[model samples]
Target: MTQQDIRKVRQEERVAELCAGVVRAFSGERDLHFRGRRLHRGRMPLPWFAPHLHPSPETDDFESFRGVADGLALRIAGSDATLHRTLQPEEPVERMLFEMLEQFRAEALVPEAMAGMRRNLRHRHEQWSLAFHHSGLTETARGLLLYAVAQICRARVSGEQVVEETEDMLEATRFALAPRIGHALGGLRRDRFDQAAYAVHALAIARTVATMLHEAGGDDEAPDARQNDTDDKRSVFSLVAEMDREIVEQHVSAQSGRSRLLEEAGAAYRVFTTEYDREHEAATLVRRELLAELRERLDRRIAAQGVNLARLARELRALLAVPERDGWDGGQEEGRIDGRRLARLVASPAERRLFRVEREEPLADCVVSFLIDCSGSMKEHAESVAMLVDVLARALEQAGVASEVLGFTTGAWNGGRAQRDWLRAGRPAHPGRLNERCHLVFKAAGTPWRRARAPMAALLRPELFREGIDGEAVDWACTRLRARSEERKLLLVISDGSPMDSATHLANDPHYLDHHLREVLARQEQQRDIAIAGIGVGLDLSPYYSHSHVLDLAASTGNAIFREVIGLMAGRHRH
Candidate 1:
C-alpha cells in the first residue's frame, strides 16, 4: 500500500476503535466490533447500536452516545429484574397507559443509576415535549402525558419542583378525564406516585376515550362509513404523511453540528440496497449422487491427514470441557486420598480415601460456518476454499461441533436500469445480466458434513462464480446460524478481498458494498455467542475482520491450510 493509503487505513482503524470504545461504555460489553458509526449489541430487539437515539439526528453527538448507553443499561436491567412486567394491553386506552408507564419507568430508573443522567434525561424529555407540542396525534398526546407524570415523579423523588407547566398540564388532563382518572387514582395511596397505580390510571383514561369514540358510531354508521372508506383511507394516509414529516423535522433539528468523520467512515460500509430475486436460483442444491462422489473424493483428501486431524479433534474435545467438576462425597473409588483432611478421616475410619475428583465431558455445543466469496476473481481460490471448508467441516464434526459452508456472489455483472432496457428490447448489442444476486448454501448447520459433500464440491464450478456481495451474504449466514441451538457459534469468511459488486458499486458510490460488509461483521460480533473471523485468499481482510488471517493457498497447499484453519477454530473453541 502507498504511504497515503496506509495512513488512511490507520486513520479509519483508529476512528473505528474509538467508536467501539463508546459502544462498550454504553453496552457494558467489551468484545464488540465497529462498522461505520453504527455500534451493535447483537441479540438485542433493536439490532443496530448507533450513537444517537432512534429517529433523532440531534442526538447523534458523541455525548449523546452516553445517554443511549444509559438507556440501554436501564432497559437490560428492567428486562432482567424489574418488579413490574411489561404490560400488554389490547385496548387502545390500555395500550396508551402501558406505553406512558413504560416511558415514565425508564426515565425514573435512569437517575437512580447515574446522577448526571437526570439532567440529560430531563433535557431529552423537554426536547421531545417541545418537538411534539403541536402534533395532534393521539400517540403524541399519550407521550405528553407521560412527560407530565415523569416530571411529577421527579419532583417527588428529588424534592424539587420542575417546570410548573407540567403540573398544570397533568391537573388539566386529570380533570378532563376524571372518571377514567378515578379508576387509576383509586389504586394509588394519596401519598406518592406508585408506578403500577399511575399506569392503571392512564389505562382507565384511555379506556374512557375509546368508549366515547366507539359510542359515537353504530351499526348504521358502519355501513355508511364503509361506503366512503376509500376517502377515509386517503385521509388516514394524509395524516400518516403529516406525522412522518414531523418526525423527519425532529430528526433534522436534532442533527449534530460537529465533524462527521465517524459518519463518513460508516457510510463507506453501509448497505445501500439489497437484492433477493436470485436467491432461489443461486442456492441450487447439488444432485445426490454427484454430491456423494464429491464428498468421497474430499474424504480421501481429508483422510491423508488422519494423524493431524485426530490430534486436533482430541485437543478440541478437551478444550471444550466444562470448567469445573465434582467427585463423590463419600465412596470407595480409585482417587487421591485427602491428606489435608487426614484428621477427619482418622475420626471416621470408614471415610478413609473416600473422596475423589470427578470429571464431566463438555457438551459439544458449538457451530462453525464458512462464508466463501464466490466472485469471479476468486475462481482459482474457490477450489482452495472448498478444500479448506471440507477439511474443517470434517475436523469440526469429528470434534463434535456443527459446521456449514456457504458462498455469496452476484448473478449479473453490470446489470442495472440501462442494461434492463437493452434486454427487454430483444438483446440488441448488450443485454442486462440475468438474475442479479446469488447466495449459495453448500451445507446447513443441521446437516451432517458427509451429507453436504456434493454441494461442497460444487464450489469448484467456475460458471457459478460471479460478483461477490459480502454484506448480504454475511447477514444470510448469521440468520442461519441464529437458528442453531449451539452455545458457541463461529463464522469464518473466505474471501479474496473486500466486498465488490459492479452492478451496485457503479450504481452508487464505490465503498457501498465494503460498508455493508463491515456492518454485517459488526452486528455478528455483538452476538455474545457468535464469533466472526476471516481468512483472506491472497489478500488482506484485516480492514473488515477484527480477527483475520491472510493466506496464499497457491503456495501453502493442504497442510498449511489445515494448520491455519485449525489454529483459527482452536482459539474460538477454547473460549
Candidate 2:
C-alpha cells in the first residue's frame, strides 16, 4: 500500500491508545485530580480541565492542551515525520498552565486574581479578530489555534465510516465537560469579573469550534432524518389562498389522481402547519385526522404503560440501589459496564453526605414524617404522590435518616369509613415504584378537601393508636412537640390539598391554627431552616404550597417528574 494508507493506519492506532486513556479518566481509573500536574509555578487547582484532549501519560492535567500540541505537530509535519514532532513531556504541561490562566488578573487583592493571570484573556482574541487579514498567532489565539490542531489530530486518529466507539467515547467526554467548564469559568469570572469572563468565554469558544470541526470531518454519526418544512409564512400561502409550489402539487391529487403524500407527512414533523391548526387548509384536514387516529391508537396502547406510577418509583429506587457488586449490565459480572449509573451514583443524596461532595458539617439525626392525602379529588394523582413520597423516604433512608410514614383521609367522605384504615391494612400485591406498597395499593376515593389529615396523626400524638383516623395525632404532635426543644425539627408534608381548613376557619371560625400558625410556623422555620418541597402530584398547587417552594408538576408528567425529582434532590439536604 501507498504512504497515505499507512499514515491512516498509524493515526487509528494512536486514536485507540488515546481512547483507552480517556475511558480510564472517565471511569476514575486514573487520577482525575490535576492539582500537582500543572506545569506552572502555581496554577490553582481548577476543575476546568479541557475534555477535547486525548488522555496521555505524558501529562497529568489538561489532555486537551496536549491534544493541541500534538495537532500542531501533525499539521506542521503532515503525514511524514509527524511522530518526531509530537509534544515533549514538559511543553504541553507548561502550555496548559500558561494559556488557561494567562487571561486572569495577576493581583491577589483584585477580582479573581491569580499570580500572573492575563488581564482579560479576550484582549488578544479581540486583537486577533482585528488582524484576521494578517496572521501571526497571538496569546489569546493560542488556546483556540492549538485546540483546532488537536481536533484535526483527533480526526486523523479516528477514521471515517466504520465503528469508532472509542472516538465517540472521547468526544462524549468533551461534550459532557462543556457545561462544567462553563460553571468553573463562571465561578472564577464572578470573582475576577472581566478577565474571568473572557477566559470562560474563550473556553466555550474553543469547545464549540472543536465540536463543529469534529462534526464537519465526518467522524461523528449523522443525526436521524425528519420530514422537511413547507410552511414559509414568508411565502404567500395564506395570503394567496394557495401554495402553488411544486411540493403542494406533489402532495395533492395531480392528473394521475395521486395526491401528494409528503404534505400530510410534513405536518407530522411540525415542519408545515400542524393538522390541529390547519382548519382553513382543506388539503391538510384529512391528513390531520389520520394522524389523530394513529395518535389515539398509540395513546390507548401506551396509557397502561403511561401511568405506571407505582412501577416507575420502584424501578428508580432499585436502579438507585444497584449494588456495586452486581455491576451495570443486569446480566453481566463485568465487561465494560455502562449507563447513567455512575452519574446517578454521583448525583445521589446518599453519595453527597458520605463523599463530602459539598460540605464538612456533620448531619444531625431528626425524625421525618411523611403526610399523604387520600381523598377522592386526588385519586388520579394518588399513586404518583405515593411514589414521590416514597422516593424521598428512600432517598432519606439511603442517606441514613429515620422516617415515619402515614396516610390520612376522612370517614365522612367515604361511606363513613376512613381511607386511612383501608390504606394501613393493605399492601400492594406487586412491587410498585419507590414505596408504592405503602398507600398506592388502596383505592379509597373521597373528596381531597375532606378532613384528610389522618396521615399527620403519628407526629401529633404519642399514645394514640393510628386506627386510620385523621387529625387526632397531628393535633397532638403539634401540641406535645411545642414544649420539647430539639436542635433540628424536620417535618415534610406530602398531600394533594385536602385539609380541614374550611371547617376550622368557616364553621368554627378556627382561631387556634389560623391566628397562631404564622407564629408557630415562623418559629419552626427558624429552628429547622425549613425546606418544604410540596409536590402537587397530578394537577395544580394553587390551593396547596402556593405559599412555599413546591416542585410544582401542574404541567409536567411521569418520567419528567421522576427525573426532575432526582435532579432537584440529588445533593440537597446533605451536610
Candidate 3:
C-alpha cells in the first residue's frame, strides 16, 4: 500500500468521527450540547433542562440517520466530514455548526480559501442563532430558525448530493411545485417516493416550516444558488423566516417590554391604537398606579355622568399639553367655523379655557339622528353604508355630542314593508365599542329614504295632522331642539338622490298611510337652525344645500365617510 492509501484511510476515520459528533448533538447526549444552547421541540419552543441526561441511542454509522433528520442534520453530516484542516471548533455545538459555514464560501474553494470559509460562515451562523434564540420568539420559531441556519451548510449541493432547501425555501418551493406535481400526478394517490412516503412530510417541511421561519424572520429571502444547485434568484420568502427573526431581534424585542407588543416583524396590524384600557383586567398585580388611575378616569369618561365641562376641558388641555399624543387640534386647521375664523387653542388663557369648556357639551343636548338608506340600492354600496354609519356614530361621541343612529329600508317586494330598522342611542365607551353598537342599530325594522319615509309619518303626524313634510329625523330634530337651549339640533340624513314610495301614499292609494309624500317634501322647504348635513357614502345623495334640504352634502370616498362624519359633527358651537 502507498502513502495515498494511508491518507485516504485517515480521512475516512475523521469523517466517521465528525458524523458521530452530529448524531450526538441532535440526540441531546453528552459532549455535544453547546454551552448556553438547548434543543427546542413541540408546538412552541420553551425552556427545559437538558433532556434529563439519560441513556441514549447507540452510535450507528454516520449515515445511519440518513434522511431521518432534516437538512440541518444533512449539513451537519457534510460539515463533520471536513473539520481539522477545514475548521476549528470553539465549542461542542460550533464543531457541528460549521458544517454549513464551510459550504457557502465567499470565494474560490482552494485549500486555504475553503478552510477560511468554514471558520467564518460557522461563526456567523452560530452567532446569529444565539442572538435570535436570546430574543423572545417562541421555541417553535426558534427551532425552525436554527434548523434553517444549519441548512446553510449545504446551500451548495455539489455533484448529486441530496440537499433539501431551507425550511422557508422548501415551503415556498413546495407551493410553487405542489400544484404542478398534483397536476402531473393527475389524481393518482400521492404516495410512493423511491421507497418512502414523503409527499405529506415534504410539503409540511416546506410550507409550514417556512411559514414558521418567515414569521420568525429567520427569513424568507432565497439566496442565489451557490454554483451547483438548480435554484436561482432566491425568493423573498426564502430569507423571510431568518429576516423575520433577525428583524424581531433587531427592531422589535429590542424595545422595552412595554413597547415589545410591536416587536413582531411583518406583524399584521389589525388594531394599532396605543391604549391599554384592559391592562389590569389581564393581570391582577398592578405595575403602575398611574395606569390604574388613568383607566378609572377613562371608565368615568365613557359612562360619564353629570357632564363636568370644566373638568373635561382641563382633561382635554392636559392631553394636548403632552405633545406626544395626537388629537383634535382646533388650533391647526383654523378655517371659519360658524362665521368666525376658528378659535385656535391658547394655553393658559381664560378665553381659551372658557371656550373649551363651552365646547364640552351635554350628551342629551347634542342629539342627532343618522337616518341612513337601507333599501335595495344600498347593497351595491354596503361598504359606503358601513363607513357613513361608523363615522357618524364615532364623530358624535367624540364631540361630546351624544347622538342616536337609525337606519331604514322599505322593500317594494314585501307589499311595501320595511325590511330593516336599526336604532340605538347610548354613550359609547370606546371607538370600537361605538362600532359594535353601530352594527346593532341596523338590526331593526327600517328602509331607505323613499320607502322608509312611510314610518316617519307615525312619528311626525300623530294628531289632527294628516300629511305634508312630516318625517322622523327632521321632525324629531326640530321638536327636540325646540327646548330653549343654546345647543344646535343636528339631523344627519344619508341617502341616495332618490325619494321612495311616500309621495304617492294618498287617497288614490288609500291602502297607503293616508298622507301625501310629495306634499311633505314641499313643506321641508321652510325649516330653520336644524343643523342638517347629508353624507353620500359611495353614492350620489346630493340633493342638499338649503334651510329646507340638508345644507351640507359631502361626497365621502372609501372609508373616509366615517372620518368626515366626525369632522362634520365635531361641535363648532353651532347656535
Candidate 4:
C-alpha cells in the first residue's frame, strides 16, 4: 500500500475506535461497533446515524467529530426508541420531520456542565444547515421548507439563535409555516425534557409539515427535481429518509413467508429428474483468448482496488487456523521433566527443576469453497463477483488454506430436459425441482491461483448464466468440502437473490424452491460438520442462511468487503 493510503486507513481505524467508545459509553451497549462507516449493534445496523459517523478526511477536525459523537450519545441515552417508534409518522416528509425533531430534543437536554457539548451541537447543526443550503436544496420549494423547519425546531428546543447565514433565505418559508405549526413549536420548547409530552407536539408539527408539502403538490420530487438526472449527489435529509424506507422494506421482505410447504407435515422435497444434470470445467466453456483478456481486465481492476492481500491472509489464518503441537520446549520450568536437561541441572547443582512442554501453534488446515450464483439477474454483478472471489482465493492460498471457486446455474432458461420429462409424466403435483442443474468448477482446491486465473475469469461469460437451484448447489459444495481432510471446512455462497426456477414454481408452488433451499441450509447447519455462510450482492440472504452479510459492492472498498466476508465466516454476524 502507498504511504498515503496506509495513513488514510490508520486514520479511519482511529476514528472508528473513538466512535465505538462513544457509543458504548452513551448507549451502554457494549456490542456496538463501527464496521465500514456504519455502526452495527451486533448483526443489526444502526443506520440512522451513519451520516454523522462519517467525517470528511479533507476537513479532519476532532471538535466536529466530537460534536457528532456527543449528539448521537445524547440521542441514545435521552430518547426512548419504543416511544419514538410508536409516535413515528407514516408519510415520508412527516417521518423525516418527526425524527429530526426528536434528535434535536435529545440534543437540547445536554447537561448544564457540558458547555463544550452544547457548543459542539450548535456548530454541527450550523455546518449541516450550510451544507444543505450550499447544495442547492434551499432553492427548491420542498427542500427549503424542510430546512427552515429543522432550523426553527432546533432553535426553539435548544433556545439558540437561528443560523445567521440562512436567515434571509428562510424568511419567507418561516413565515409560511408559522401559522400551521407555531402552536406545536411552542409545545416542543415547553416539554423538551419530557419525551412522552414532547412527542405529541413533535407529531403535530410533522403532520403539519407533511400536509403543507402535499398541498404544494411537489413534495415527492421537489428536492432534486432541478438537478441533472445523472448527478449522484443527494440531500442528507433525502438520504436518511431513503435509509428509513429501505430498512422497512428489508424487514417486510424477511418476514414474508416462503416455508409453508416445508412446514407441512410429511411433505418431502423431490426432484423431477436428474438425467439432464451436468458438471464441467468453467475454462472449457470460453475461448482461450477471451479468457486471457478477461483475466487481464480483472487483474487491472483488482490492482486498482489496492487490497492488502497479505494482511487479509494473516487475518483469515488467525480465524481459521487450528492448534497443533509442533515441537517441545525444554528448560528448568514447571512442565514435564526433560531427560536432555538433566545433565545441565546436575552441573548447575542449583537448578532443581527441568521440564519439557509441548508447544502448540496455529496451523491453517482449512478449506473454503466460493459458490457463485450465475443467474440471469446476477449478470450485472458478474465482474464484481469474479474479482471478489478471485482475490479471496489468492489470499486463502497464501494463508496455506485450500480454496475452490465454483458456480451453479441452469442448463437452459426456464427448464430444459427436466421440464420436458415432467410434462411427459403428466405434470405430477408437488414436483420439487423442474430445472436442469448445471455446476461449474472455475478452480479446484488443489490448483494454484495463478494457473487457474484464466478459468476463474470465465465468470464474466454471460451465456453461462441462467436459473439458479441453490439447494442442490449447496449440497454439492458441502459434499466436496466434507471429502477434504482439512480440519475446518467453509462454504461461502454469493448470490443476489433467492432460488428462482420458473418451471418449478409453475409446476408445483411459488415457494417450492425457496422452501427447499431453507431446508437444505437447516439440515447442513444441524450436521455441524462444515461451516456455511452467505454474502448477498446488494441484497439480504438472511432468509436462507443463518449466518449472512449484505455487501454493497459499489459503495464499499475491496478491503472493507473482504473484512466483512471474513467476519461472516468467523461467525461475527449471525442472524
Candidate 5:
C-alpha cells in the first residue's frame, strides 16, 4: 500500500474506533460494531443510521464527524426499534417516508445543554441537503418531494430553520403539503419523545405523501397539484423510464401466474443441445495488453483500499485450518503416559511416562472456488467484484489454501446457436437450458495467484458477460472443487440474481432454470461432498443457497467489502 493509502486506512480505523466508543457510551449498546459502512448489533445491521456512519475525508474533521457520530448515537439511543417496526407502513413509498421522519425525530432529541452538538446537527443536515440537491436528485418529482418532506420534518422536529438553499426550490411542494399535513406536523413535535405517539403523526404524513404520489400517476409527475417546470424535469430520465418498465413487468408477471414446467417435465431437466457448450481460459479471450492494463488498474484500486492482506491471511488460516493427529511423540516433557516409553522413564526416573501418544497439528488442506455470475447486470459491479475476488485469492494463497477464480455466462445473447437448433427441432416442449454454456477459468486451483493475476482481470471485460445459467454453473464449480485432493472443499457462488436464460424461460417456463438451480443446490448440499455458499453481489441469494451473504456493492467501501467477504468465509452469515 502507498503512504497515502496507509494514512487513509489508519484514519478510517481511528474513526471507527472513536465512533464505536461513542455508540457504546450514548446508546448503551455494548455489542454494536461498525462493519461495511453500517453498524451491526451482532450480525443484524442497524441500517437506519447508515448515512451518519460513513467515514469520508470531509467528515473526518472534528466538528463534521462528531455531528455525524452524535446523530448516529442519538438515533440508536432515542429510536425504539420494536415500536418502529410495529408502526412501519406496508407500502414502499410510505415506509420510506416513515423511516426518514423517524430518523429526524431521533436527531431532534439532542440535549439542550450540548450546544456544539446542536450546531453540529444543523450543520450536517444543511450539508446533506446541499449535497442531495446538487446531486440532481431534486430534478425528479419524487426526489424533490422526498427532499422537501425531509427538510420540513427536520426543521419542525428540531425547532431549527430549514436549509435556506433548498427553501426556494421546495416552496411549492411545502405549500402543497402544508394544508394536508399541518396537524400531523404539530403532533410530531409534541410527541417527539414518545415513539408510539410520534408514529401516529409520522404515519399520517407518510400516508399523505404516498397517496399524493399514487394520485400523481407516476413518480415522474409532480406530487403537488401545481406543475412547476422543475418538477417535470429529470437529469437521468432513463432511470425513471427503466423503473417504470420494471413495475409494469412485475405487474404483468403477477397477473400471468407462475409456470408449471417443473411438474410437466416430471423433475427431469432436458437441455436443448450441448453441442454449443464451450470452456475457455479467460485470459485467452481478451488481448494481452488490455488484460495487463486491467490488472494494473485493479492492483492500484485494491492497494488504495489498503486491505490488510497479512491479517486477513492469518484469520483465514485460523478458520480454515484443520486439526490432524500427526503421530505419537517419544520422550515428551508431559503428555499421556506412553507404555512404549516405560523403559526410558526407568532410565531417567524424573521423566516418568512423559511420552506423548498423540500430537495435533493444524493443516491448511482446503481448496476454495469462486464462481462468478457474468450476467449483463453484473457489468456495473464487475470492477468491485474483480477487486474483491483478487484480494481474497491472494489472501487465501498466503494462508496456504488453494483458490480458483471462475465465471459463467452464455456465449451469445438470448441463447445464440442453441435457440436456433431448438427451433430447427420444431420447438420441443420443456426444453431446459437453451443457452450455449460458456464456463471461464480465470485462475486455476493449482496456479499461484501472482501468475494468474492477469487472467483474473477478465472479470472486468464487459463483453464477456451475456447471460447466467446459475444451476449448471454451480454444478460445474462444485465438480471442479470436489475433484481437488484437499481434505476440505468450498464453492462460493457470487451472483446478483437468479438463473435467467431468456430463451429457456420463454420456450419452456419462467421458472425452469430457477427450479433446476434449486435442485442442483439441494442435491449438492445433501451430499456434503463440498460446502456450498453464496455471495450475492447486490441481492439476497437466500432463496437459492441455504448459506448466503448479501454484499451491497454500491454502499460499501473496499476495506468494508473485504471484511464482509472474510466474515462470509468464516461462516458468520445466517444459516
Candidate 6:
C-alpha cells in the first residue's frame, strides 16, 4: 500500500479503538466497530459497525465522536432491556418515519448521557433544518410535511420556536399521527430501542399520513395506492435521499458565493502570515563573521557615549550576588548554638561555642529574549535597532545574564498561501501587505553576543523585510523562554507598529490578527510568569502591550535607545 494509505488505515484504526473504548465505558457495547470515515453518512447507532461519520472541518472530531458514542451507548444500553431486533419495512415512508423518530430519540437521550452533547446535538438539528429549508424541495407536499416535522422536532428538543405554518401543519396532522408519534416517543423516552416497536409506529404514522392526503384530495381510495397514484406514493426513504442530495449541492454553491463575498470585503491591501523555520542544522546560530563590522561600529558608538554599559553590568552582578553562610564559631551571635557546642559546654564549663548564622542571597539568574520586527515598515529604524540589540546583548553577556536576539518578517510579498489561492481564482491583487512568516534567529540563548554579531548584521539587508506576524512571534519567543533555567525571563519586542498582515485581514475580519495577539499574550500571562515589554521604534505600542515604551529613532541615537531599554528592563523589577 502507499505510505499515505497506510497512514490513513492507522488513523482509522486508532479512531476506531478510541471510539470502541468510549462505547464500552458509556454503553457496554462490544459488537460495535468502525467502518470508515465517511462524513456524509453521519453517526450511525446500528447493531453492527457501519461507516462511522467524520466531523466537519470546523468541529472537534474527537469530541463529536465521543458524543456519537454516548448516543450509541444509550441505544446499546436500551437494547439490553428492550431486546431490539432489526425491523425491515417494505415501504419507504415507513422507513423514513422510523429513522426520523429514532434520530429524534437519540438526540433527546444523548444529552442525558453526555451533557456536552446537548449543544452539539442542537446545532446538528438546526443545521439539518437549515439544509432542508434551502434544499428547494418545499414545493412538494411530502417535503412540506417533512420540513414541518423537522421544525417541530427541533423545537421539541431544543426549545426553539416554530413558525405559524409549522404549528398549523402540526395541528392538522396531530389528530391522525399523534398516537403513533407519542407511542414511539414514549417507548424511546423510557430508553427502549426495539426496532419492531418503532416499525409498527412508523407503519401507523405512514398510513395516517397517506389517509390524510387522500381525504384532503377528496379521493376515496385505499391507503395502499399505486406508486403513480399520488405524490405521496414516493417512499419516505427516496424522499429523504433526494432531500439530502439537494442539501449538499445547495450548501456547496452557497459556500462558493460566501467565499467571493469575503474576498470583496477587505481593502485593496492583502496581508498574510506563513510559518517559516530557519532552524534545520544551526537555526539559532548567528554567524559571528557576518556581524563583525556592524558590531565594531556599534561598540565604538556606545564607548563614545560614556554611559559605560560594562559598569551597569557590574552593578547588576552585585545586585544578583548571594551571600555565603558561615557555620557556628566562637562568636557572640545571639542565636541558638550547635548541638555539639551545647554538648561540649555540658562537659566543660569553659567550653565556648557560638550559634551559626545562615544567609541566602538571590541568584542573578535571568534570561532575556529580544524579538525584533524586520517588516518593511521597520527598514528606516533597522540599523539603530540592530545597534541597540548589540550593546544590550553585550552588556547582558558581561553581567552573565543569558540573552537571545531574534527577528521576524515574511518570506513572500503578497505571495502566501492565501494570496496564491486568491490569485488562482482570477481575483484582483490586493496591495499593501506581506505574506508568509519567516523567522530568523540572530542569536540563541547561552550563545555569547560577540559570536552572533554576523547573524545580527543580517538585519541591515532590506530584502529580509516582508511583513510582521507579531502574535506568533511573541508566542515563539515565550516558548523559548519557558525552556530556559533562569528564574526571571523577560521578552523584549522591538516593533515599528502594530501587527499588520494584510491578507489575513482581507480573508477574515480586520481585527483577526489583533485579537489573536491579545489572546496569545493573555494565555502566556496566565500560564507563565514571564516579563514582556515593547519598545516601539517610531510608534505607540500601548494597545498591544501593558508595559510599552515609545521611542523616536530619529530623535535618539543608539546609546540613548539602549539606555531606555535598560531602564525598561530595570523597571520590571520595580515594586
Highest-scoring model, TM-score: 4
TM-score per prediction, in order, is 0.47, 0.25, 0.24, 0.59, 0.54, 0.45
The CA lDDT at 158 in model 1 is 40
Residues 102-128, candidate 2: write the lDDT tens digits.
222221122234212222222222222
lDDT of 3 by residue, 1-575 (tens): 23343343233323433443554564444332111112222112222211111111222222322221222232333333323224333332332222223322211122343454344333333333443344333244434443443333223212111122224443543444344333422211232211122223223333433344334433333345232211311222232244333322421000111112122475221211113112111112223454345344433422322233344334323322222233333432233333232242243334332211113322334455665544444444444344334333443344444454454432122222111111122322211100011111321122233332222222111121112111333443345445535355566666543433342222112212112222222244345456665554322222121211111222323333233344445421110
TM-score leaderboard ranking: 4, 5, 1, 6, 2, 3
The model with the greater TM-score, 2 or 4, is 4
Q: Give the higher-lDDT candidate: 1 or 6.
A: 6
Model 5 residue pairs with clashes: none
User: Which residue runs of candidate 3 sit more than 4 Å off their true CA positions?
Assistant: 1-365, 411-486, 502-525, 538-560, 566-575
Q: Is candidate 1 or candidate 2 better by TM-score?
A: 1
Which tens-of-lDDT digit does each residue in 1-575 have in candidate 6? 23343343334334545665665666544444433221111123243211112233222355555555555555555433232225534554544554555555454555455567676554444444544555555445555666665555445543546654335655654554456465543443343244456445545545555454434433333457534544544543344566434423422110111123233545332333233334321222335554466556656655655556767677556544445444434444456666555666667777555454454544567888899988888887777777677677877788778889988876666547656756676655432233566777878997887677666677666677877777778988898898998888889889866676667657555565565565567677666589887775644354455555655555554355555667677653110
Task: Give the TM-score comparing model 2 with the true structure, all chains together.
Answer: 0.25
Question: Candidate 2, 1: how far from true, in Å?
Answer: 72
For lDDT, the strongest prediction is 4
lDDT, model 5, position 556: 62
lDDT tens digits, residues 519-552, model 4? 7888898888888887877555665676667676
lDDT of 3: 0.31
Candidate 2: segments with Cα more than 4 A from true spot? 1-367, 411-489, 501-506, 510-520, 529-533, 538-547, 550-575
RMSD of each: 15.5, 26.9, 28.2, 9.1, 10.1, 17.1
For all candidates in order, the CA lDDT equals 0.55, 0.31, 0.31, 0.78, 0.76, 0.56
Name the lDDT value of residue 18 in candidate 1: 52
* Model 5, residue 403: C-alpha shift (Å): 1.5
User: Model 5, range 1-575, lDDT digits (tens) per residue?
Assistant: 23344344335434655766777788888776554334667545676442433424533355556777788889888988888888897766667678778888898888889887789877777766676677676786766776788888888998888988778888999999899999999998899989999999999998997777555436564456545433322322222233323423322010112347766545688788999999999999999999989988888878777788898888888889988889877766677877777887678787655657687887899999999999998898898889888988999999889999999999999989999998899988777889899999999999999899889998889999999888888889988887889988988888877788789889988888878887788888888879888886645455566666667665566467777777777766633
